[model samples]
Target chain A: MRKIVQIVLAAALLVPAAAWAQQKGGVVIRSVSEVEVKQKNAEGKEEVKRVDATKTKVLPGETVIFTNYYTYSGDKPATNVVIKNPVPDHMIYLDGTAAGAGTRIEFSADKGKTFGTAGKVTVRSADGKERRAAAADYTNIRWTLEKPLNKGAKGSVTFRAKVK
Target chain B: MNTRTASIIVGLLLCLVTALAAPQGAAAATAACTGIGNTASVAYSVAGAAQTPVSSNTNTITVGNKVDVVVTTTDASPGPAVVPNQVDVLLHYTITNNGNANQRYQLSAVDLATGVTTSVFVGNQTVTDAVLVSAGTATTGDNAGAALATTATVAAGGTLNVTIKATMAAPPLTDGAYDVFALRARSLKVDGTTLEANGSSTIDSAAGTCTADVVLGDGAGTDDAVAGASPDGSHSARSAFHVVLNNLSVSKSSAPYNDPINGTTSPKAIPGATMEYTVVISNPGGSSATAVTVTDILAGTLTPVTGTPTWSSTNGGNVPCTNQAVANIASGGWACVGTGWAGSTLTATIPTLLSGETATILYQATIN
Candidate 1:
């Protein structure tokens, strides 16, 4: 009985408790990360192979690509979709790497309190001065879908970060 | 932008904690098993009503351990000065662990030429918490009570000091003999003193969940580290022991002065002629000799006409000396006992003679 309860509890923790996800024609989101590895192809030409970051050794100073895939299955078109992701601990966000089709990108340096265009973002320095934010200073990234998404519309957003 | 104008900007924050995903390595390598996990969230509205947001699954990656060490000679200046047949010449070195994890090291000292380990020490000591303890075991090598352990375990960013002791061979050592010793230290595994190797399992099957790998990251040190490897696993330093004894030497010469045939120039030691004798006492080694005195005698055919002997001092090399000729009084001049041609007996005293220093003494004698 205890084992059964533990299994159920584990399943419950893995799934989100949002009512929209339980209903049909709802949007589903999936997040994953990977690293680019150099390998020789059949033609003997060097090519970059994407390896799953979670299943491989990621050392310090190595770059990791974090991606978010989304699918809209609603009966009507969904609008005003916004996705935000915070920079992971011990990692620095890469500049101009947050990309998505038909979406407006913004950055936040103060832990998502406010957002602005990448160049317009600012951060306070240790010497009591405010200056333009560097790539490492970005704490969160926001992607706002520019167009409405109908049923079965699928797209993805991605950004690169380096392990500290 | 779209026909629908419903915008809520919902904040859906999900706290998914990953094990071993803490901030690490403020100024050093990150902890080997640190796992960095991230989770992203999304929020949207259907037509006009805002819906509860959802978060994606967590993804985590672990950091690998980088193994590196440093060994350096930390002996005091002037090194150890040993005399002939002297035992237990001491040299010191320090080993530091620069890796992210605790590690053990194998330490030893060998001859630079023959690669033979002849300087094993006894009574090795370890100090902790202001308390002293020694591994008191006598070995074949002459010992000044240095650290004698062949293996040591040190925490990350920790250091250990080792002393290597050597004995000078009597029959082979000259006045200035030299011996070179190499101190080597290699990283070791958990048991039985095995050398640490670079880990090649790039894909650890279950790599991402807080499991760390090992990599070589130490640079070559004094030819002890392997240059072929990307980074070497061992470090070494060379220190030398010097034999310094032969410091005292004496040389003397006599010249004719004020002779009837030749006065002070082109003169030989003829009858009724005065000769000037210059006695040089010098130190040629790397140590000091104190309370030095020179004794000479002039009698019979040679009579001492010396008012006072003059001496000058020159300091060079490892020796430090000053002229003490004013204090050097020649006693017992013209003293003879039942003898023919027993030159005047003269004795000059010098307080101290340093290494690489010379003192010249001159006096006059008349031949009859």
Candidate 2:
């Protein structure tokens, strides 16, 4: 009887420990701050009048600049904190200027199959002239931090380009 | 039981329970969470559009004539809509001249659609004289059976007055809606004139055409007529006339040299005497007149008005006289003396004239 009681107690403690480990392994992502973007016309008037990012029908050659900042609030340092931005069909990527440190930038020319230096990728023109392509020419852009971002660390990226 | 044995038993049981419970816990966590949650979104917006009231005239113009049509558009919204608020339209036209003389042509308009026809005549007269005449559907081409004649002669510098009537065919347009039309005119001539072929000479000649367009506000009372649909639709204009002249004259000094002035003139001076004659003309209508030329025909001793007529601003003016004898004038060619006098025709052009404006010419002859 004594042995049985001890075994039951040990089993209960082990069960809880295993469950806790599994829970710790699962990722729990939450938005720490709201994302906001803005755009203006040639007259410097804000054009946020009729934009619904989630459901708006954007026309060809129309531009919407995204000025967004995000924060990581999880306990452990977040690895591979990649920001994957899909380039819209009608928009050419302009710039990826940083708002803070701990952010590295890279671009993909072939729809995310591979990434290369944003400033070093060469595009050949129809006349056989090779020229450096802009970040906007890529299918997507990713910003990887040099080190795992600690909790409560915030950073931002700004992108601009014309509608093609 | 012994302490060692009890501890071992407990460890083994614990290991078994943990192994069993670990899988169960993971399975339970794997199940997706289900809950009834509601999401709501609110948005505010202001929508607008640029409204322009466009107006124009129809196509099909008479040869050697022109029409003026207007098309006006207004921005309907009080505020600005999206960018690029422009409207485009076309004006189709045909011009014809049914007279004997060749005619020069020009056209102007704001919109290509409004069929506003304008032409010069001698005063308010039919196009019988050498001048530009407006050809309408009722009167086009050389067929006398079709075209209406001008009331006065188209002197070289004389202007004619004409009125434009825009007829809107039923189903009145909406108050703010735009109505666009077109007008065109051009000169016309016999097609085979340039060829050497001895083509059959026929009075039926092809006339040329020119056109002008204008944009006006919706005639509807609900819309402002002069202001256009928007605040940016206004225009200013000035009117004037340009004139050109060609002179034909004949001279004689003795009684035996009495011969009526014909298109051909020889400058012959009698040994003992001298004579001179002058002619004058004027424009008494509205609008510019053009293509003016003078021709002198001498048939007998009677000396008709001498030299081409001079231009004047007033209605009636005496022509300068020449010292030539009047005995050689043709019996029926004398203006004042006989009922058979054959009057001569002189021509001039004013190019353009404004309302209440006038152009004149004078002629005179003397026999010594």
Candidate 3:
């Protein structure tokens, strides 16, 4: 009986230590909004400038940009990083806007259950006919990293949506 | 240093610059963004073990004002015969709000009076609730009969009805008095100005795409929405009233009289002669003639005797002529005789004479 009790206590202590090690080698993510503005440069030429989105009131037919930033602040390398975002109501996601280097972008028409490339994701139309999902039909977007994220590495992904 | 040695040194320096300018630690990543007011999150695995996922804050946007309305009138040509000062005309209108939001429409009217020498008299404006009518049917009668509303309420995808009535003034009407009835509608804002598209106000805008009520455009202004052309080929409405007068004819003849001095009888003009005069009246138009009166003047000094005037149809059917005061109108009596006989004139009155119907009067007058 004494030998069995000593074995259980050792196993419990080992498991928590292992979990703490895993937690120390993790990544953190944050998101921010940006807006495109046109202003005249010193040469009097109109130039586009990206600035923080500060507009509290947005009208229909207006477009806004959302960017997700990720940083691996861990003691070990993070692998197979994935990012997913749902499409909001009263807005239309701009087609072909998801972009990042060395990353594979996919779209989901059924929330985030399954994902496919453009013209591959299929869904039933209002008439119950099966057809390829359009950009407007995309309900979620995902980005899959092709390489591991080393410690102290940072990257960002951006997409655009227009108010309906 | 020699030229070849200098060239070798420059090549080495170029190679070093290229190596120094090479991209450092730039990792390729895949990014995708799509959706409105969606949640964005990221997750990763360390050494093949999944880590906790992170989520983004919710983001959202705002849709403005959309306005639509339709107005229409039922009758195109409401053609009917009317006696001047004896008929009231009624017109019907329908206003509909086809938008997604509730709306109020301001109402008004226009009298085209097309080809009319004198304008029609429209009064006692009354409106009532009504259902839509079938094609080619005239709008008449008062369902509600309240005063015309300056503004009418209609829910989105709903309809409201309006009815207007006007009376025709008395005679001096032309044979073909034609006119048009045009009804105008405009959307009013809370401030009573025109509504502009996408404006914050639900009522109306200061400026909009709708120009005239009858103009086929958006309903941003009062003049922007209008009832379409009635079936009568007018944008508003069309009506014609036939006006005409009735006619009459009269004649006189005498029988033989006995001369007191010669004790011989001859059919010659003499005093105390019983002369018979006959009068005929007829209506030859598509309308009935009412309150017909006939007055005769004497060529010579003839005295009207106290007797009932005989009345009959062209077929010789006779109706009794009763003596009553001329002021006693609407007395169902066949005819009215003069109360007291007078010199040089006789009179008769009949209540009504229908189309193609006639009345005859017979009485004797003695020459003085």
Can you give the TM-score per candidate against the true fold?
A: 0.61, 0.30, 0.43
**Residue A90 error, candidate 3, Å:** 3.1
Worst 10 residues of 2 chain A by lDDT: A26-35
Candidates 1 onward: DockQ, in order: 0.29, 0.03, 0.21
Candidate 3, residues B1-368: lDDT per residue as tens digits?
Answer: 00000000000000000111111131201001112344678777665556667676654322222344555655444334444444334455566554333455555444443333332322211122222221224333324421122444455455665544445444444444443344545555544444323334432212222221111124332222323322211122223333333433334444423233332344344776545555555566545666566666666766655554332222232434333212122223233434323455555655566666656555555557
**Stretches of candidate 2 exceeding 4 Å from the true structure:** A1-52, A55-82, A96-101, A108-119, A135-138, A149-164, B1-268, B271-368
Candidate 1 residue A157 C-alpha distance from true site, Å? 3.0
Off by over 4 Å in 3: A1-72, A97-102, A125-129, A150-156, A160-164, B1-36, B63-149, B152-222, B225-368
| Model 2 lDDT tens row, B1-368 | 00000000000000000110111121111011111111111111101111111111111111111111112212122111111111111112222221222222222211212222231101110111111133322323221211122221121111222222222222212222222211211221224222111112221212122121111111211111133322211121111111111111223222222224421144344422223433322333222222223334443443454333331223222332232111112111212111112353223222322223332222333333
Tens digit per residue, CA lDDT, model 1, B166-185:
44444334433445555667
- Model 3's CAPRI class is incorrect
> What TM-score is obtained by chain A of candidate 3?
0.81
lDDT for A110 (candidate 1) = 92
| Interface RMSD, every prediction, one decimal place | 10.4, 29.9, 12.0
Pairwise lDDT winner, candidates 1 and 2: 1
Ranking by DockQ: 1, 3, 2
Q: By TM-score, who's the top model here? A: 1
Docking class of 2: incorrect
